[model samples]
Target: MDRWTWPAWVGVFGGLLVFAGLFLPAVVWQSRRYGRLSARRLLGTAALAVYGVALIAYTLLPLPSGDLAQWCAEHGVGGVQLHPLQFIADIRRDTAGLGLRSTLTSVAVLQVVFNVLLFLPWGIFARGFAGWGVLRSTVTAALASLLIEVTQFTGIFGLIGCSYRLGDVDDLLTNTLGGLLGALVAPLVLRWMPRPAELVQDRGRARPVTALRRWLGMLVDVVAVSVLGAGLGIGWTLVGYALGDRTASAPEVLTGLLPVALVLWLPLLIGSGASLGQRAMWLEPRWSTGEGLARGNLPRRIIRGLCGAGGWGVLTLIHGAGPALAAFVLITALAVPFTRGRRGPSCALTGAELVDARAVSPAVPRAAASTDR
Candidate 1:
């Protein structure tokens, strides 16, 4: 549309970044709890967010133009079709012949078609992700359509002085029909893909530690640490200014260490045993056999942090690490993929192993274990 311009592109880019910022944590959480992250699941998550955003853009965009006061005075917003058959009649009127142009090229017909197609995803997702059937999907589609109409009627929550878009009954009818169609077609696609119920069932299955999961956890942990560092950097600047030193160097080195203490060390000391990333990815450090959830004590956490990536390794940027620090980082990073069970070098020294935190299996009697031994 003519409305999509440089500013629209910028808004889209910013929206995507914001969506990713929020969605990544949820993906990590789902992966942690579900014990697996499939390509399908990742795409599904992205598609859901994109679809919702697209609807908002399509329905509430090209915002009211010209002077608000003048536009409100003219007031071209309040319009609706309470007649359910009005759109169908309009489509019939748009057609001039039985040819392809008459059937598909009419702008009125296309607009009506788009309105119906817009909610197709609602049906697909309702069945594929949430396992909704025809009745539920219909209800959901009706409610969502109502919301869109209400948003149009309300002039985007009253930011605009008056409504600039029309609320239509035909849209409600077509969208609901489209949703019902989508729900009916869902089983066909679902027959070829993972069922929603199966995915839910997989949530309870025990999963072992893996290199990929550990890496994901660490990646999230890196972001968590950087955020902490930035916050600390800001605080340090404030303190410097308060002391009448406007040009004082910020405590950037100390900034990185606080995250190591809070996200890594503090949890071990408190018996949670998982960093922010570890919690997100469902990884936990074990201390010993039969000690289940072996979150280390304070000394162990401090020792591990200094020796591994979570500890002093993060200070490489601010403190400028020597060859020893470089080697430690390289070795620890390499050991994760090469070592059996992908154990971190820090784990070797700390006498702990990172395991799947939420993993579980049917428990046999203690006497059964003795008998097997």
Candidate 2:
């Protein structure tokens, strides 16, 4: 039980780290793939990540920490157990002369049950989340079990030098059976999860401009700037070390100017006036004239970019601008919910409108279409 508890804790902590790293990318993907976010699907995805880590922790963890040779000699088991239904005999032998209740609760019986239960989620996720058929799910589960057993048999492929845990064929059979059972009941278990086909069908539809979407777009921008800046900073530091320039460090200009220009300015000057994040979230700023139609132009796009993330980036490079930047971020964030079309400070100041990239402009009147022509 202690072994199990520690692995579960490790899985939980590792899962959180994995989710944090993947959250932005997941949001962008869900937005694009589904044309909107589904909280239920996101929760399920997170659970799957937890399960993945937990599975690895359970199968191979608590490696011989000290005196590998002594530990293996003391605790290691035979290389393999190839006999099927061996757990049945072992359970009976271990529970001999015990009452029916005691036999059912014996360690041998519980061990078999745990092995079956361990892989049950694998089948459920396969059928419910991945939408795989029973045969495919069962086969995959069996193959996965085989791989785990093989890894144990080879002592993690010779890294540990010798087998420390038994590689049991009975465990594989039980686990595959559990997976098969889960696949059979997956439809009922995951009735609320949106099917992949359903999301694909709705992919072309334009979703409303909401506050969450706006915030997500901003998050993407922040993440892009941070990643680009860090990568350049590291590269510059490495170059300095290689060239014997011990005092060389990342200049504020190189780290600050380039990422902002590439991520914000270039996009605003080009098609759609959408920053990288905005493009990822299917959002773009247009010149809103308080008329039915809104379009983008170069000058206003530049102003909008400056008033938004690009401005924030520049201020970050300037020392003693922290308070102003904080105020700008707060005001922009607050303006999203209250402003028309959910425009932030950037869009409001420049008279730019935020819209879904998929939104089609209203068809022009025949006379209007011909007049321009």
Candidate 2, residue 156: CA error in Å? 3.0
- How well does candidate 2 match the true structure in TM-score terms? 0.87
Cα lDDT for residue 94, candidate 2: 94
Q: Per-residue alpha-carbon lDDT of model 1 for 293-360, expressed as tens digits?
A: 34566777767766665564355455456775667656766778876556577777787666665542
Off by over 4 Å in 2: 232-255, 288-294, 361-373
**What does the lDDT read for residue 215 in candidate 1?**
73
Q: Which consecutive 10 residues in model 1 have the weakest lDDT in total?
A: 364-373
Tell me the tens digit of each residue's lDDT in model 2 across 1-373.
6975877887788988888788888888888887888788888788888888888898887677688788788887765899999888898789999999999889899888888888898889999988789999999999998998888888899888789778999989988988888888889999898877788898867777888889999989888988998899999999999999978999877788888777767777777778888888778666634344356667777788789988887787778999999998898788889987787889888876677766745422223222211
Clashes of each: 2, 0
TM-score winner among the candidates? 2
lDDT of each: 0.68, 0.81
